[model samples]
Target: MGKLLFYIFCFLAFNSCIELNNPPNIQGTWELLSATTIRNDSSIVQDLENKRMIKIINQHHFAFLNHDNNNGKDTTAHFVAGGGAYSLVGNQYKESLEYCNFRDWEGHNFTFSVFIKGDTLIQEGIEEIEELGIEQKIIEKYTRVKVGRKRNIYATPLM
Candidate 1:
């Protein structure tokens, strides 16, 4: 009985240590490192190389923005932005779009498997952009960034 009690104590201690050493929180401003669209036919598309993207997540809502000022083409404006409330349940992250630059996307809901690896966040989901005319698997990798100045226009990192 004493040996069994000792073993249980050791196991509990080890598990508690793991729970205490949780990784960095995911609520922060993340700068887009790469955005890739993978199609069912095994083709890939890279569309944000020259664009600057910032993802901001607070306690209940999140926003994503792509700044295209460097492209020199103002199709509509200097940036394209989308935002809405979000819910996180286990590994399933869901977003209900309430605001978008394009009106067609106003009532859309999106689901993604969100994972934070080291200082980078990886999001994988199926996206059906109205203009694209097809459903594609979108994967975005972002790294944590700190905004230094107020005029930068990018979001500040979460506290």
Candidate 2:
């Protein structure tokens, strides 16, 4: 009886570390859930709130689509950055975006802590605001909707 109980305990412990929905390949494309921009005020709070959509082409590339429900205006911006990386641990994924020698923003690094469950991906990170040219971290959250099917970026161009 004691041996059986020990085995049960071990099984439960091992299974707890496994995520029910393993991280999806998530290599193709994804769309953003919201749109916000840093305010020019002292606090640098995000303002001009609007429902925004973003498409992540891959682990390295992404696009931001802005939507104004009040005015019915839509605009999209394509961005490509180098040295971005992603990793998965259990059900959690870590994504890093580096403004590596980019035009306006350089030497800027942003890290996100995310989790994948079922068909949803939730990411949370801190965005630093340069106040008086001083950097201060501000918390931000992002939800990405995985569309249709997961296609290999190498096989086809992400739309």
Candidate 3:
């Protein structure tokens, strides 16, 4: 009985010291690094050279804003903002777009498969809107933004 008790104690101690691995948390601000859109048997890579976009995520919601880095001076300067509630289960993420500058995109739900490696996140999904005649596969990569760092050169309050 004494030997058995000693062995059981050793096993319990060993197990207590072993840590269980958990999935990385996805809550934070992420900056768009690259985006690729595919449709109609053609693929196009978005031009992000003169623009900055960032997505902010919290417990249950996410918001994104994109604008030209030229402070709206360029002829093609434009801005887009949208946000909504999101649900994340494992790597499956679903966004319920409640508000968007584009009225047609409001109330739409988009689902994407997300993967995070270190500080980088990659999202891939298909966006289809029959009424809008839009169907495309989008792959976007983002880098997590660190706190206290300037999000972009054309900084606004949204950052």
Candidate 4:
């Protein structure tokens, strides 16, 4: 039965090697941690900032509310959009918006790194904000909850 055992091993290896870019399981709540804006030449800007909350309902829909962290007011904004796709292949995730209705925003694409350890999740990426004409790299941490937690859910990456 040595040959049979080898065949089974090969089968399992093949299935395990299948990498999905932007896997669907990431469809949940992700809170923002920290962000830094960079110029085209990779220079850090002192005044640029961003704080956000991202919610992915499914493979084709997601919502986001981002605000300036400088004000410290913790303002809330809403975005409703459809026809978007996301996937996590290896350690990188690509989030794309086919059409979004958040003030002259459409076809926006962003890439970030995702790490999952136990129930904690972390996402980091350089997100493009066309309205501000700048790109910012953000590091976000999160913890999974049952959706009934009495917290704002988007308060901090993990609450």
Choose the strongest candidate by lDDT: 3
Candidate 3 Cα misplacement greater than 4 A, ranges: 1-24, 152-159
Model 2 poorest 10 in a row by lDDT: 150-159
Please give, for residues 1-159, the per-residue lDDT of candidate 3 as tens digits. Answer: 999999999998887655222334678999988888999899998888799999999999999999988999979698999999999876788999999999899989999988887777888998887899999999988888989998643321121
RMSD of each: 6.0, 8.6, 7.4, 6.4
Q: Where is model 1 more than 4 Å wrong at Cα?
A: 1-24, 69-78, 128-133, 147-159
Model 1 / residue 153 / CA error / Å: 16
Which runs of model 2 end up more than 4 angstroms from their true locations?
A: 20-25, 34-50, 57-63, 67-104, 129-159
lDDT of model 4 at residue 147?
75
TM-score of each model, paired residue for residue: 0.69, 0.49, 0.80, 0.52
Residue 19 lDDT, candidate 4, scale 0-100: 47
lDDT of 2 by residue, 85-118 (tens): 5565444455454433344444455555555444
Q: Give Cα-based local distance difference scores for all models.
A: 0.75, 0.45, 0.84, 0.58
Clashes of 3: 0
Worst 10 residues of 1 by lDDT: 150-159
State the lDDT of candidate 4 residue by residue for 79-156, as single tens digits.
Answer: 344436776667777777665656455677888887775555777788787676766676656555447664333443
Q: lDDT, candidate 2, residue 10?
A: 93
